[model samples]
Target: MSRLAQFAVFGHPIAHSLSPQIHQAFAQQFGIALQYRTIDAAPDAFADAVRRFFAQEDGRGANVTLPHKHAAFALADERSQAATRAGTANVLTRLADGRLAAHNTDGAAMVRDLTDRHDLDLRGHDALLLGAGGAARAVAWSLFEAGVSTLTIVNRSPEAADALADAIGEPARVHTRYWDDLGHIGSFDLVVNATSAGTLGQSLTLPFSLIGSRAACYDLGYGPSAFGFLAWARAAGARYAHDGLGMLVEQAADAFQLWHGRRPDTGPVYQSLSTRSS
Candidate 1:
């Protein structure tokens, strides 16, 4: 019998990560025996921990979450175009020659969830992205690439928002909004909340005008963190509201495909996760 393939997700507070369960469901689909775990690696120890994980013979791949995606990007010997564009990587795989390959699936995951699952058309749509953190940055590029007519990123720090807008190129299609100016920004077809406020259990007091009767609200943070935003969006009369659960599963599916040649079906897994969460 072949030795079991090993994988894991690394984060500062990784105990609550659902990646192992998601990957286990994917593995069961292909009859692939694998052991997936979560590792709590401090910021200073992140690089070392990942290095050690991929250096193992049984190690196949790992996902990097929150606080460590940039570290994972730096640690890789090779990076995909997506990772290069995003300036961070959330997935890493060990090559046959012992080199580490890195890529970002966060953007693709969001795109899949929005377009494929939600049936939202990105072409010529106006989007409002909240926050300027790594997750927001990754999804911003993806939204632009998906043909969004305009993307206005709002953040607490004006400089950060401006920097992200500049990096997105296409100055005509991308703009920055100060957190205080959110109310004056008008409405958007999509409003994505990528702020850590969700995870921190803080409610965002977004401008009521930003959400039209038909606007869709997406909270990039999942699980308990998304509840506040979901409530806020509903109270604001958003037509649709969703958390990052779909993105999480979709992104994991992308990572699974990168590590293993076969892509696992995400429908059943997503349904299973949704049911369990509810």
Candidate 2:
């Protein structure tokens, strides 16, 4: 048999990643043989690890997560519009000429998961975004693309949220508030948690008043990391609440399509993982 295509995901504290399982399932759907690994690399080692993976390990493509998304964006020789818009990249492809191309699927994934998977209508909805890191930037862009009327962003470090709003350059539609000011922000039709607080096992202790009676809440963390916000959302009476497992699978499908020129059906894969996660 010909050598299997090589791919991997790079992140810090990567032991909990499900990218390998997700991608392998996708590959099996198309009868494609490939190997996907998870590489744990701190911020300092991210670039070097990516370079070595592509150059020496015959890596055809890779996924980036957490603290490494920005580094992946910077390391790429070229970027897709999605990456440029988010100012970070979650997918990296190796070109025939040995150049690295970066892309961000987080935004598209979030949009698909919310609108398609969960039947959440984003158009004209007032949305509240928590956090301003890599995931938040991408999710913010997606929410706009999905037609959220206004977006309020809040973070522990207000400067980061402000910077993201500035980057979006939509002063009229995008706004920022301090994390402590969340209680005064009024209710929202949609609330998204892109913060690492949950991933780091910290509670945000957000106000229940932030959730409208018919609101939907989403956390951009999966498994145990997603339980905190999801629990809070349920207790706050959100009409719908979900973790990022669906988004993760959706984004991985996007990356898979980019790398393999085909899209695998996400339903079975999501159901399998959801079962395991639950």
Candidate 3:
């Protein structure tokens, strides 16, 4: 048998990431041997860590996460359209010529999870996005590309939120809302929580009025981290609510395809994770 394809995900505080499990499961479906690991590297050391990983004879690629997306974008010799649009890179691959190529799979994964798995089409829908960090940056442009009628971003700091909206560059469709003005903004067809608060064991503490009685809710978090927002969605009378597990699976599948040239069946992987989590 051929040697295992070596891969890893680089992030700060990566100990809790599910990327290794997700990628390994994807590899099993294709009968492709692979070793996936996680590396915790802060911004200052991120570039060096990436260099060391790719230096390995068999080191193929890595997933970029949390505080490293923008750095990864800078490290890439080339970038996919998605990465360019997002101004970030969550998927990085070692090219044939030894150059690093970057791609942002977060948005594609999210759009697929919503439209294909959940049957939620964002077209002509107004969405309220929470948070203005890397997670938000990687997926906001994709939301617009997926045909969201409008995207209103809110963050604790208005300046950060405004920066993201400005970068997305569609004033007609993308706008920023200050946290204080949240009460005044009208309801939305969809509300997406992309904040890292859940990861930190903190709750968003958002008012229930943000969601229209008929709106759907999605939190870009999974497992226990997703519980807070999801519970709030239900308590607030959302028509539908789901966590980001499906989005995670879909995004990992995109990265896997980039490395192996085959997309594994995500349904089985998603079901397995759900069952295990439950």
Which has the greatest TM-score? 2
Per-residue accuracy of model 1 over 1-278 as CA lDDT, tens digit each: 86678899999888999899999999999998899999999999998788888775457899999889889999999999889877889999999999999999898899899899989888988899998878888999999999988999999988988988998777899998778888787898889999999787687777678887688999998889999888888888899999999999999999999888889999999999899889
lDDT of 1: 0.89
lDDT scores in order: 0.89, 0.92, 0.89
Question: Which digits, one per residue and each the tens of the lDDT, describe model 2 over residues 131-188?
Answer: 8988899999889878999999998999999999998889899999888888787999
**What's the C-alpha lDDT at position 85 in model 1?**
79
When sorted by lDDT, best at the front, the candidate numbers are 2, 1, 3
Candidate 3 structure, TM-score to reference: 0.94
Query: Least accurate stretch of 10 residues (summed lDDT) in model 3?
Result: 133-142
> Could you tell me the lDDT of residue 235 within candidate 1?
86
**Runs in model 3 with CA error above 4 Å?**
none
Q: Which candidate is the best by lDDT?
A: 2
- Model 3 clash tally? 0
Off by over 4 Å in 1: none
- Which rank order by TM-score, best down to worst? 2, 1, 3
TM-score of each: 0.97, 0.97, 0.94
